[model samples]
Target: MGKVWCVGISPTDPRLVGIEGVTFHSTVNGCDTLLVATNKNGLGGISALEDNVLIMHESLATATAKGLHRMVVLGDTSSLEGRRWKVHAESWDSTMGVSVNSIHGMGQLIVEVLARSAALKGMQVILIRVGLATERNINRHLARAFTHSSVRLESFKDSKIPDLDAWTAMCLDESGEFNSEISSEQWAPSRED
Candidate 1:
């Protein structure tokens, strides 16, 4: 049977020494699968596994540093929107807190992540962002990056609010239909929107 390894890194403590021993144990056990989760700022450490799942908490650059040569990344869809927005949302609890600098930084980080992932041979990469209400032109940016990098990019809509804000708004619109329909059912025939 193949083994699996899981590592978690907190932004407050990104030192590998905090996770290395456990990660090493999993590797020595012949673990064929590895899962890593980190906070928004935690870069953690260089990953030794060739095939694994990378979950970036704060920075995509950190995840890219793993240099897996081939692997998949699982994260909230909004991860590409820029860390400023995330920081604002966390500190202020409002989406309006994102700054232009943070958005630009996030964009660059995303591009780097995609480019690095593409460089790996026979590597499959998947990026997931949460609460993607509006692609807000992100698609065009991503399209260009993927085209130049020759990497496969796939996006899904998630509407779980702050937890999955990376999802496109179209997805949320579709979900809203359910609520609209319910409201309509409770209203008079003449009260349609």
Candidate 2:
């Protein structure tokens, strides 16, 4: 089975680890929201969040080049003017409490970068929005941001927030390579807290 990466705020959701093809990766660390502004010159904020997103894009791109064919992103979504979408990242500094950063051109940048990678074609990318009681429209708007990209996009709003097993099942089912034998407990935490 191809390697699958679980990325986002809590990418290492315990349920997702130990699965045969799943691995956890974090792009940001205590920030509650990762807001991607709609316009190029939208409200400007700190570069820390934007930098983290770029790093994420780079990591995924490199992994794609290395034959990673599946990805599951866990986060909440938000949109501006009903056009652009944003994702949550880990806190840049846990000591500072939760922070909010407004990044312009995030949607376009995500698409443009990922779409440029020939290795990402046919990749199964799943965006699992983790909040339940919030609005769902933003999720769709966020999902649409990648509509024209090379990768196959699937977005779901999980109110109850599923575990690693459910996420792995979704990725494997999408990739048509589910293996029932691999136990979720077989994998250990790879990142330090």
Q: What is the C-alpha lDDT of each candidate?
A: 0.29, 0.32
Candidate 2 residue lDDT tens string, 62-162: 65555544443433322111221213322111112212233433443353334334223654443333223223333332333223132212222222432
Global lDDT of model 1 = 0.29
Q: What number of clashing residue pairs does each candidate have, in the order they appear?
A: 26, 9
lDDT of 1 by residue, 23-100 (tens): 322221343323343224433233321112233322234333443322223233232334454533332222342232
The deviation in Å at residue 70 for candidate 2 is: 1.2
- TM-score, every prediction: 0.30, 0.36
The window of 10 residues in a row where model 1 has the poorest summed lDDT is: 177-186
Location of the lowest summed lDDT over 10 successive residues in candidate 2: 168-177
**In lDDT terms, which candidate is top?**
2
On the 0 to 100 scale, the lDDT of residue 117 in model 2 is 43
- lDDT of candidate 2 at residue 89, scale 0 to 100: 27
Model 1: residues >4 Å from true position, as ranges?
A: 9-29, 42-70, 82-120, 132-193
